[model samples]
Target: MSKKPAGETLYVILGLLFIAVIGLRTISTPELWTHLAQGQHNAPISFLASDSAVNTTWLYDKLAYLMWSIGKAPLLILLNIVGLVGAFVLLLRVSEKWGGALSQGFALLIAGHLMFQMIDVGPEVCMMLFIALFLYLLTTQKSPAVLFGALIPLQILWTNLHGSFLFGPILAGLVAAQAAQQAKPSGGRKKNQTNLSGTLGLLAIALLVATLINPSFIKLHGQVIAGIQSPAPVYHSSLFIEYFQIPALKPLILFTMILGAGGLITLKKRLPLTLTAIAVFGAFLVWTSPYHAMLFAILSLPFIVLSLTAISEYIHSSLEQMLGGKAKLVPGIMGGVLVLLFIASIIPAATGCAY
Candidate 1:
């Protein structure tokens, strides 16, 4: 096999460096203290606090405490950075089949900027990492046994780590529907495709069951329901900010949306139904609260990049014809501009400006 392109490797390294710079910011979320305190207790549920009926993020708390005890806030910051970077890597892999590294890198930078705004030295970091990993496994795994087998344990762990674990079953169900839809067009392997879809559906159910393996058992889901109906008072402050606070970075968000739409309209082929479903789900979350903009951004990054890649290809083709041999310089200049934009995006956070 021929060696991979040097520019791809450079793009990856540069992307990672940008991520590190963004992740290096000060830990500002006050919830980190509450989580650290909870981790010191043996009981999974917080008996004294009225904020939560069940400790949905007990495992994350425990892990956070461990990291804090070792190196204090610095260690926790490192963990947050790791989660952010790991999520980006998985996003890179997921989008690789649809686009080139340059496009993937650019898309992820947009998503990461949005996602990292909400992340701190708390369970949110773990939630982001788990979400990315879960999406990767669901979309790529071919074998039903392997897919379900992996997701069940992951769900169990995620349920203990964060309340957003409900997304696991939701995603499974969506992917299962997509699989079933694909089966209709598959001629000879229709039966196999149907089986895969059926397995995914079952996996969705299994994930729901696995969620009960936590400390609160069935009561945990009740808490989820209650929280949905009326969010806990602890979230009131965040809820207010997320719902009403106009983000200064809204321009970037709008830019990504325009780019994604432009790409979708210009696409040469139909976008996959699974991606559409996921993106819709993500949009719904953001609609519920701006705090979830990251969720929408990250979940839709692959789709966005797919569009960007198509647009880039179209542009590159035009340039190739116009400039011929001199067209090679364009990618380098684009790469430099990408780096500059990444730096500019983080300037607000770096200088203590609020979102």
Candidate 2:
């Protein structure tokens, strides 16, 4: 492991309490309370299949119950904060792996908007840590066996932990596809891509199998699909306003688009096909299901961070050239602009996710 930089640590500590900043603007509803109450003496799997009146899977219900057993109900909230903070910490680490300092803008954006929300004690925050870790591995881990092995436990655990476990294999397939494309031979391209393609294929299939190990087995897939396809009222009237329908050109979404454009224009290095494909898919998910914008954003964060960092460097270099090599001024100017953007991003965050 490498030493973590001080700048990146801002979110790690503050993020633990980020959700608390908004005070009473919480997403916790009646259902979460019921689930935790039942989980006190019931098995975790019992809660998975028996939606009963809750009509929702309880991901961390048992955790909450066990915490309460030890006189630690408050500890449940702390874990949520820990996972949220860890997600950013892992993200910063991954972005730094690609190239140090590329994560600055994205990290700041997260701290400004994502950190302070009412996402209290849900499995989704825990889910973020896993997704972030997977992405971190995606960026730095090259060994096929290692990735495959890692996903087996992760998918199994995720499937039981949350309904969004499918994201694990889906992301894995996209990355593997990217790897295969990159590994293509100079000649007879199709033939050369086989080694990685085969490995990735096995990994994907294995991950799918891993999902089956969950309590719901194959039925879990159908349940998740049905949940997605069903026209739920949660999209519009849920307690969590973030789940509400997104307007055309919402401020955050619009800013994300502009940031992406600037990144493409300024990025000095070539964009990987894998990242390009993931970004497209991420955009589609966020557009279609605004409920999971936070999840999609976190998953695609590495690519976003990389792009922004490239833009920053490009501007600095351009300014240096324009100023006849007085590069020192460039840092001060960009740094000030970064501070301004950070301040500007908080404006919408105060209102929380505009569901």
**Candidate with best lDDT:** 1
What C-alpha lDDT, on a 0 to 100 scale, does residue 125 get in candidate 1?
65
- Candidate 2 yields a Cα-based lDDT of 0.62
- Put down candidate 2 lDDT per residue, 1-355, tens digits, no spaces: 6665665444333332333342223435665566576576454334456553222344466666777667655666556656776776787677664444425554445533532332445666767788877777766776887887787888787787777777777767877777676764566766656666677777878888888885556777887888778734524355655665444434665566566677778776767766666666766766665555666566666667776677767766777778876876665565456556554544444555432
User: Cα lDDT for residue 90, model 1?
Assistant: 87
User: What's the true lDDT of residue 18 in model 1?
Assistant: 65
TM-score of predicted model 2? Answer: 0.77
Once fitted onto the true fold, the runs of candidate 1 whose alpha carbons sit more than 4 angstroms away are 1-3, 42-52, 184-186, 231-247, 317-332, 343-355
Task: State in Å the error of residue 213, model 2.
Answer: 1.1
| Residue pairs in clash, model 2 | 241-355
For candidate 1, write residues 305-339 as lDDT tens digits. Answer: 78888888888889999999998988888887887
Q: What is the C-alpha RMSD of each candidate to the true structure, in Å?
A: 4.0, 5.3
